[model samples]
Target: MTRRIPIIPTAIVLIAAAIMVRLGFWQLDRLAQKQDMLARFTAAEADRTVHPWPRGGIAPLGYTRLQLECRSAGPAQPEAGRSASGQSGWAQVVQCATPEGAKARIVLGWSSQPAPATWQGGAVTGTFVPKGEDVLVYADPPLAGLQPNARPDPRDIPNNHLAYAVQWFLFAAIAVIIYALALRKRLRG
Candidate 1:
């Protein structure tokens, strides 16, 4: 006697497996895109040459060194920041009036304690970093009492797409194996 595979269940399993595999490939594609973005960031950071801050409307400043002499427009605004050594702490961000009369914010430095007295602003040299809709300067050789926090890395961005892809592929294999085992058991009985 010949045994026939259950058409409905078998079709469902194949469709599910195909979808899982497709999801895995999609994740892999995301991984490649992430890697390319990181590479671009690195390339931008390599050149030490500093450029003047843009006088016109805002621009994309993901990874570039720049020079600016901004005076403190207000007291320091505290925000989260990471140290060069990867320590998490509070960073002082001060509002400043640019030479062209544009309002801008600059991340002064990272510290374990709350921000010190009202920050005394000066001619600052640092890297321009994109933060949400605003761009802030991450001071290099950080201001006198503060530690250096410059050249924020793109590698810091999480790139777990490959691992997620592996998980999807594994899920597809597990589904196939379980279905095969169930089919064999049904055939035996």
Candidate 2:
């Protein structure tokens, strides 16, 4: 006098829920890793060690002070950014050829206008920032008569793993609840 529970559909639902729960735990692990990385970056920022222009990876050196001579520089291009005082504006960036023959992007300064600045090349000292696959040096002092660009802070990097983990957990719960409701209705009918 009772309908048997569906086998294949129930199996699929449980399996999917298990996967989602596992993913949630994985995100939590990632959150811990991100916290550790941010702590290292904060320490690096506080250290006064100045390194020469890096020809290798920049990830481990982010937020550290670096100095490099720009043997030649391309025309400046203005990118939307914020000034040191937190005012939204333009960032004057230039592609420079380093003495070691490596190319580097330098954020010369900030400006209220989108127009680029006129800078050929010179000795540059600033904070090393790893942006995606590229490396950018944020000038410590305003360059080419432009305003200072906002200093790079590790806090600016987003740590959304906790949010992602919560969303995954919610999805798993929702799936199980929806399946339970459907199964209940089928058995009643």
Candidate 3:
């Protein structure tokens, strides 16, 4: 004797599975877009011309180098950062007064010791990096006696889209298997 799957439950499961699959594809698309952005960032960094710091409240250009004269405003704040060699250590960040009389933070360098003597800030050139809502410049070779910090890495940006896609596909497979098993049990009964 042949048995038929329950129409209502089967239809619901199929619909849900399709939605999950679509979500997986969407994540994949996002992954591609993120990769393209990273490539553009790398290209921008390669240009050596120093761009002036943005005036007013405008956001600084990402991955571009800047040349500016600024002096130490107050004291240096210690923060966590990585060295060029990928070693973790404390970095000295000091508030600097821009030529335009605005305050901006400058990452002097990475040191094993926290709060290294205040760096004599003057004519400075560095790459501007954006961490969340805040943007700070990383002195390429670093000033003071600290080690050089690693260049901003696009690869470091998280791309978990592939994992998310796998999860959605797995959910679809499980739904199909469970429905088939339920149908078999009902037929036996």
Candidate 4:
């Protein structure tokens, strides 16, 4: 059927289509970044052992790789972030066991979202950062919520941006298509 299309609608649709395409690309970029980051972390941990934080005299200013046993389970707590609103994070922990089965415990900060847990005879290679220096003795507790042991697997985190990007791009495309139809109708009219 012949119908009149308006220029405004046509223009809006085209603009929307362009935006959607841009969003889709953004998601792809995010996915790439995440994969790269995962690869880097994996490489760093491979063939490496987790170590205790250096005691004093200038912290390594970096992380130390250490392998913790699975039996070292600890309750995780939220280590507040600088952001005004942030999730109570997992206060990751490590437990060192003596041959006799006795144990020493330490609360480690979140090592990203747990990835596919690497285990060779119940051990995990993780980077150890020194307990952040606390100027106020009581201001922020250095450690909290310790458990026996655990080896959380690395998760293949979803990149929703890709989906969102797709959505935006789809919207943009639809917008453009609508605009084109509108323009066509208006021209005919």
Give the best candidate by TM-score: 2
Stretches off by above 4 angstroms in model 1 are 1-4, 55-58, 67-75, 80-89, 95-105, 120-124, 131-136, 141-145
Please provide, for model 3 over 1-189, each residue's C-alpha lDDT reduced to its tens digit, 9 standing for 90 to 100: 777767999899999999988988988888888778778777768887787775565666668888767755457788888888888888778878876776667887888777564776776678887777766888766877778877776567787888988898889889889888888889898
Candidate order, TM-score descending: 2, 3, 1, 4
lDDT of each: 0.78, 0.90, 0.78, 0.44
Candidate 1, run of 10 with poorest lDDT: 142-151
| Model 3 lDDT, residue 142, Cα | 82
- lDDT, residue 32, candidate 3: 88
lDDT score for candidate 4 against the true structure = 0.44
For candidate 4, give the lDDT of residue 177.
66
| Model 1: colliding residue pairs | none
Model 2 CA lDDT for position 149: 96
What TM-score does each of the candidates earn? 0.73, 0.92, 0.76, 0.45
Which portions of model 3 miss their true places by more than 4 Å?
Answer: 1-8, 55-61, 68-74, 95-104, 116-123
TM-score of 1: 0.73
Please give the RMSD to the true structure for each candidate, in Å. 3.6, 1.7, 3.3, 12.8
